[model samples]
Target chain A: MGKSIESILKKYDNCSRDSLISLLQEIQENEGFLSEEAIVKTGKKLKIPTSKIYGVATFYNQFRFEPTGKYHVMVCRGTACHVLGSLTVLQELEKVLKIKAGQTTRDGLFSIEVVACMGACGLAPVININGSFYANVTAESIKEIIESYRKKEE
Target chain B: MSIQIEVNGKKLEAFEGETILTALKRNGIRVPTLCHMNDFIPSGACRLCVVEIVGNPRLVSSCSFPVSDGMKILTNSPRVIESRKTIIELLLSNHPDDCLYCIRNNNCELQSLAKEYHVIERRIHGNKNSFKLDHSSTSIVRDPEKCILCGRCVRVCEETIGVSAIEYINRGSKTLIGTTMQKGLNTSSCVNCGQCIMVCPTGALTEKNQTHMVQDALQQKDKTLVVQYAPSISVSIAEEFGMAPGTDINGLLNAALRKMGFKYVFDTTFGADLTIMEEASELIQRITEGKTLPMFTSCCPAWVKYIEEFAPDFIDNLSTCKSPQQMTGAVIKSYFAEQSNLKPEDIISVSIMPCTAKKFEMQRETMGRNGVKDVDIAITTRELIELIHLHGIDMKTIQPEITDSPMGVRSSAGKIFGATGGVMEAALRTAYKKITGEELVDFKINAVRGFEGRKEAKIKINDDLEVGVAVISGLGNVRALLDEIRNGKNDVHFIEVMTCPGGCVAGGGQRIGVDRSFIEARTKSLYDIDDRETIKVSHKNPEIIELYDNYFGHPLSHKSHELLHTCYMERDVLL
Candidate 1:
């Protein structure tokens, strides 16, 4: 893991701090999460402070501090989604999962978070349950969607 | 003179010196084209407008090809379509196909043209351009992946607004639209006016929206959501509701606020009038005290931000009077809260502005008072339209009603605050009267009015006092005037500068669907409103004048100066 992290950082040796963040984001997307050993190796290879590497990882919403669940639920909170009652859909998810936004369920079946404008104004309340878009969602529909995810996890 | 042009064996009549594309368009001929904006010089990079000329072996771009007498043009031959299709296919090869998830998805001209041409799939997806999003400024966002490198935004920034904050960085396929030194937009010489966002054909440039935060505030029971509209918004919001341009929807707007669950629906124009009272008094004090001569109006946040970032030397010349939107925010947080017996934190002040820079202006440290930010949220007229649509409000059928009293009652001087030279004219109306101790029999001061890039006039006060006034819109125009002043050619006693081209009426955050004629018509309506109003002078505004005499000390008093007159800081070093 450390060797892989060092190689990844070496690939972007000439990149700026912003570029490093982008590179780390891409790496995290592929690996699911950044381990402590991977972060130390990245810092050492990139010639940046470990604290600085952690700071960049924590700054953006796209960067996750912890490992995500097998199933990730992203509910859009953009203007269009809000208008179409995306918050209600989010609320239903919280109630069912017994967790807040950005928190995975106790059973590790779901992880939920809100995103800004997903570019769907007319079709609001867009739910990305397991990387698949479920547009024009309602509270009832959200429940049905989550049930499918739960059954898959089981 | 009529020029004969042959189009694929068909004779067509065109003017002597029109571009082939324009001549073709005038004759009801459709040609596949892009990168040819109506407002700026044509950059024939798209190559979709390539036409076969009779005498020329190679096809020429119709947009850049000038029509000559008896020139033969073939716009839509099989060969031309194939070339155009291939050009479009190459454009789509690296372009993102997630239109439903793009901000300008439906409204994008590029997307519409793509669908029209049926170039749905890309043959090549190798080595796609990967661009990280830049959300540095409060007014504008840059998603480089969406940018087609049309250079329209860059041209508009340089040619129109005269703020060349954005330019092409790197070279070729790696070329990206960014600040000169890759600085954060706020740190760059960006005025935060958002004119670049207006001309962008895709979702590459957009206003940083706080609509979700506003929605959250609206849902909170403890929070009192109060909204105020700038002078320009009343004249233009009607266009968003599909009403005729310049339709006065003040009543409907007020009624809509009630329907939208707003605790208070107020007008920023009242604060505009208040600004006149304060600014006029400050001008008089500056003249008498012989302190800062030729004071610049600071109402336009874009101009204020520009002066703060680039021209810090002229900070002393900036009139301390807070912008009307900020004035409304300050008043709502302090005076209005005291009157209503509500905590400052309970009141969520939102301004519906014609400008985007106001979003950044509201976040400045000087805007807040008593540990609470003066304004909680700032949404543009466009965002307000979206909010109205979300609530299913039938704006067309709703009858117009009056804005709330005291904070809503505005004079003609306040109404014209939307247009160029309006603030200067308003201040002059009150300043001349206050200085001479007589009414301005001729209320209309045409000296500062008009659409000229910059205008200057000398008004002789009581035959002994000559005060020079200048009005400038567009940051580039302001830069020229300021340069002249800096060179010791300072003849003007007062200067009013608005960052937008035509002023707030043609602001960066107004409705996008309206045509130039409609915007002009709406501007005319704003002027008409001022003309029709009985109260023509800012000093004559009973509410503001009463407030000055009672709670607040008289205008120019130390207390009034402290509360109303705020100073600008130099942001040059920070930048």
Candidate 2:
């Protein structure tokens, strides 16, 4: 993890501070979360303050400052998703997980977020858990998908 | 000869060798398009009119691509729909989604096409590129982010006006339409005609609005909001209220303005007559003194702005007289203020004009000779309709009423100021009498009147005095005339130039979504107004002559020149 952060910092060493968010996003996509060393090194390399870097990391919903759960659920709140009761499906998942959106259970098995329109207009309520699409979801379908993920985690 | 073209598996007979797009349109098949103009050659940059042609292997741009014999065109096929959807998706990806907030949200062709194509989301993940807004010019704005890079505006500027001021700068994703050398429109050779704004499909090019300022004035109880209407506005503004083109709604317009909470509703024609008096006197003075020969009319703001930017050498030739609209503002602030017993600063003067350039013209430093900006805010004819609608004034229900006394009334010479060659005709009507001291037999100068690009006439001002007059409409025609003058090929004693194609009636800030029939109707209505007016000649306008002699001494007098005329400034800022 330390070596990976060092390589990410090296890749974005010459990038300007204005493009730090885009660079950090690219780094987070590979490393999953921004480590302390990665944040400090990014600040040093981009000539940005460490506090400012950490502030930006926490500001955007896409940036994960800490370690994420084993299963990452992104429920689309796009125009299509909202029209097809995606909010209700999200509520069901939160109730079952004993946590809210963008939170994981005490066991650290799940994390979720609502994203913008994902270009699936006809296929509404598209939920992606661990990079797999589950379209036209209801409360029951969401429960089933979360149960399968929980079983796999176990 | 008929050409067989198959659309959606149905065979239709089209004109032999006509564009596939035109053929489809003729057969009641509507394919989305943005850059296709009936007047110009097809550019086919929009890619909305893409049709899947069998045996051709690839999608063809129907606008530019001609219909071959036995052309199998599959429009709205699954492949074609998918291709169109992809194009729309790409457009939507970078386009700003603030539809409700946008000025042209409902009127925009792009928004309508997006809704028709069912483009709900952007699948591609690309960073949104930000660009700065350009509001340097008073007439038009350049919002780069809203620009789709369809090249319609660029083509219209080059093909229609022949002013290649705006062009595509840079390349790839960073490409933008701008003036050469990235100069502000004021510094560039842009004529401020606003043909580019008229052709733009999106909210990329728009008129600078002073609606908020008018709204503020309306709310102020202490300030009296006095509004004046330009001659061209009455002819075209009816279209905004859904009335038939060329519907003479001057009476209805007066009633509507009164209903909109205006204290005094005046006519700009009165000021136009005043303009004729001053301009004709200036021309005669220049000719007699042999200084600044071939004096140009300074009525059109776009023409004035064009001269200020491109041809600074011809500044001396421009008549040192304010436009009728500006003259009305100055008169209202000073002359009308004293007559009505009101403070010039307290009386808020607003002008309704069929011009976007008038908004910029009012802001010029020289326009504040009346101790304040002559015109506080200038709203386009379309914006006046918007205000009327906002105030719940139904134009159809409003009873026809005549304009108020004095400034509200105007002569036939003032009424004709809306059309091409109007200024030259108006000036000649007065200048001939001033030179020969006799009323001419022919009231209408047939030579200077018409839709021709450039017109010239040699009228005998009595037996000894023969004055050569040239009338140029549209900025492109003006450029040619100026080139001829520079090359010493063209020599005329008097000249008139209107930046718009058909003068103020077809101005940039006129009503949108109009057909050719509507334009004809509006033009006929304008002429009808001129024919019906009792006072035909500018010299016979009793109110204007009374105002000049009783208040300001006479035309071309030191006070009249100081208050009603202004010099041009050589602008260097880029648009």
Candidate 3:
């Protein structure tokens, strides 16, 4: 819907349907998240149905439909994190942020997303907020992390 | 190349590139399958078709596994049986336990497979999925709890209907088939074709039942119940009555409707004839006047809705004639009611169609007059059969009866409106006469008479004018043709598009578990009637002629336009 999205689509002019994912990735990379208009436009560019585009986008957790909040929180649910009881920490983050994974809070200040892996598996129960990593996070530490983010926002 | 394969220790001949399922089917060996649809690419999503192969440790899904020379397959060995039973049990683990009251109770493929495999008790217990029932669409009801996630509906919607209104959303354990943005189907690009319902293996999809409304109307003493059945219903409804496929029980159907307390019964074929009168004349006018060149037939509601939403650019090209069902409903409330000395408001006009989309079409904004719908309700062929059963009218014992007088007569041309290419053939019959001032020597146009995805024929009217026509069924086949038309391919003058393959005879509202042969039989029956009948063109029907003479002066006349035609607009959807 934006001029940047249009420029990204222009690069894939006359491209076959096989270029759909890369095209979608480029749009999402520039737009932060895919909008309904973006998906519809991508479908038109790729000669695919919007329902199929949505299906593909929803299948991959990397593609989010909503824009990120001011403080984007990423909770790792990787294999190592799961074994280290990060599920409680993820739930605690969701509760503290008042939003589910891949959703933003109503205040537009905090958002939560769960990642498969952060590649820092050594930090088992890891939580990343705005590119800064918090290692070995517990349910109690989730509130403190949120409180620090709220203080920064204030 | 032909190759030898051993099935259950017996040697048999099979094609080199053929699947093991095909090889086994050719040898008359039955293997239970769920995710496999005939003539469709096998996804092997459901492993129920797994069979044992000698010297192979892993069991292979015969539907997707290609047969090779010296391949020894055991279709029903102990291991294969156990694997199939386990698959059915696992599918039932998360499935709802309401098969007794489900719409597809006995006809469901999943329930049949479970019974065949003898899945007595739940071997694997899991939490039942809690999916909200989607009753958002006027034509279809989606119950996700009963969905087996076999992806047949998803495939049929995409590959067959070419309207991927739904797809598998999310990944792994969270995956479920849904429309765009996880919204209801009403907001999606769904055309309400109901082909997904035909392919759904479980009770996940069914027509929105309207039998209760028909019953309620029957009980109303003040309502004058007037009914009309589509051309395909007589031939297709016989299968539900234990009669042979393609059986012509038109007289019996009329008698049953009358027995069910209907004040009058009519045939929508009469309306089909009326449609041909208007449609063919509209085509001739368009061609001569140099208006829209490739005029698309607007008989199939699903096709109409598809063009409205998916191909809005072609909205002007669509013939403005109301479909045979809607035309009949309009005529019933106006002309027929007037003839019977009744008011339109007192008439409860109902239509029986071989389509679920008609249920949606009846509710369209333009399909009514003065806030009174042309049709009070539209029931499918299946619902009509149910109503007969509910009224305790024995179809076998009921005497064959004729339709109500004055407006009930139909020619064989109208009767053939059930099959693919039927509208084209019917319209051509009358259009030929109207143009050349003489009847066609050979009424049957063989070029447009088959089950091909697309059929094209150039009809010669005079020395200078040759009208090219195209007939295609299944919405999937229209995309390429539409693209070509957009690219300025100007040969085709008229196009008849039916949403379901093989047309209304094999519509979504017809019986389940029917194959291509059944459809062929129904089509053959319609053709057989056309061959035997004297009145084979819509213009020859005395009733239609009389209607024009008495009320509507001519085809596309001012009065006719007010009742028999409507306009379409660009319908907005999520893409």
lDDT (10s digit) by residue, model 1, range A1-154: 2335556766787876567676777568666666655555665456543444654554455665456667888889998888878889889988988887766666666787668877767678787866688889999988898788778756
Q: lDDT of model 1 at residue B490?
A: 59
**Top model by lDDT, which number?**
3
User: Model 2 misses residue B88 by how many Å?
Assistant: 2.2
The CAPRI-style docking tier of model 2 reads incorrect
Worst ten in a row by lDDT for model 3 chain A = A1-10
Worst 10-residue lDDT window for candidate 3 chain B reads: B122-131
lDDT of 3 at B259: 87
- Compared with the true structure, all predictions reach lDDT values of 0.80, 0.80, 0.90
lDDT of 1 by residue, B45-156 (tens): 6788899997799999999889999898888787788788777777777777778988676788788777877776776564578887888888888888888888887777
TM-score of 3: 0.96
> Candidates ranked by DockQ, best first?
3, 1, 2
lDDT of 1 at B315: 92
lDDT of 2 by residue, B455-523 (tens): 999988877678898998777778778878888854598998887777888888887666667666776
Q: Candidate 3, residue B381: CA error in Å?
A: 1.5
Q: Residue pairs in steric clash, candidate 3?
A: none
Model 2: how far is B291 from its true place, Å? 2.4
